[model samples]
Target: MGSPSDPARHLLDLARSRPPTLGDGRLVCIDGPAGSGKTTLAASLAALAGAPVVHMDDLYDGWDGLPRVTDQLDGLLLPLTEGAAGSYRRYDWVLQEYVEAVTVAPAPLLVLEGVGAGSLAHAARCTVLAWVEAPDALRLQRGLTRDGPQVEQHWRRWMRAEAEHFADQRTRDRADVIVDGTAAAPPRSPGRVT
Candidate 1:
């Protein structure tokens, strides 16, 4: 066993050595409030795991529809665990509809990232779950900077929905790791093999 402060290093070691010690395939779920840099962190983690990321925002029908979004998650999760190739359609906000399809190939690790990414409904498939949080004020400012006037209404609605979802889901409580975004670099856990 090892100490509890080097998760990213351990994950990198696992990826470099193709050994069963890493256990079954892994799924890393990165969840956070809007504009918390979830996407940036997810991309870094994917690079570390030598895998690809599946963005949850791409699956939604519109600004609303949590049930349908869950359905989309179900469609992707099974095949990902079974090591089968799968594809999902991405909703295009600009086009006001689902615009195109994206294929996901099974990898040693799969990173699922976005708001609601770490809900308990997904716990079974997730090997490592992380919550990336920032001060609400920081998040709101970032949201405004990113969304612009065109998405102001949509962003507001999404924010309220996220607050409710996080209240019910309590994803932060179940997270294996909690990350605050103010650090120059993300803090890492020393390989705790849950």
Candidate 2:
């Protein structure tokens, strides 16, 4: 096994150590504020575990979709918990609406990644809930760089919305692991589980 400080290794070990919570599959939720590297972490963990990732970005309705994502997750995860394949309609950002449906077949491991991916509604079913975070300034900068300055207003609103959601969810406090998004190396001493 790799060092426990390696987030991907730590998460994979955590997932394998736990009983499957999403039917025969284990769910690893990589959740955090926008631009905080949740996607990066999810990709790394998915690669390490050979898991399929369901991005919450695809489930969100639009700019104001954060609050409604829990319901969307319920729609996606409930079927999986019943040992059936799950699916969700992917939202097209350019079209500003939901379009095609994507099916997720139950597997040994699944990575759920995004802002509301660790909501209280499905916390009980998460085999590993990891919270990644960076400073607000850095996160805002990252968002603008990726999304462009044209969406700055949208980013601002989203940051505010996510802040409120995280507080309400108490996500960090409940995390099995807490990763520093700005760290140059894999996180060391991730909280709680370590």
lDDT of 1: 0.70
* TM-scores of the models, in the order given: 0.81, 0.94
On residues 1-194, what C-alpha lDDT tens digit does candidate 2 reach at each position? Answer: 45656888988987898899999999999889999999998999999989999999999999999988877897789999999988898999999999998999999999999998988999878988999999899999999999899999999999999989989988887788888898665654344421
Model 1, span 134-180: residue lDDT tens: 88778877888876767777787888898888878877777766666
Model 1: residues with Cα > 4 Å off, grouped in runs: 1-24, 184-194
**Would you list the C-alpha lDDT of every candidate in the order shown?**
0.70, 0.88
Ten residues in a row with the worst lDDT in model 2? 185-194
RMSD (Å) of each candidate, 1 decimal: 4.1, 2.0
Candidate 2 TM-score over all chains jointly: 0.94
What is the Å distance of residue 87 in model 1 from its true position? 2.5
Model 2 has a clash total of 0
Clash totals for all candidate models = 6, 0
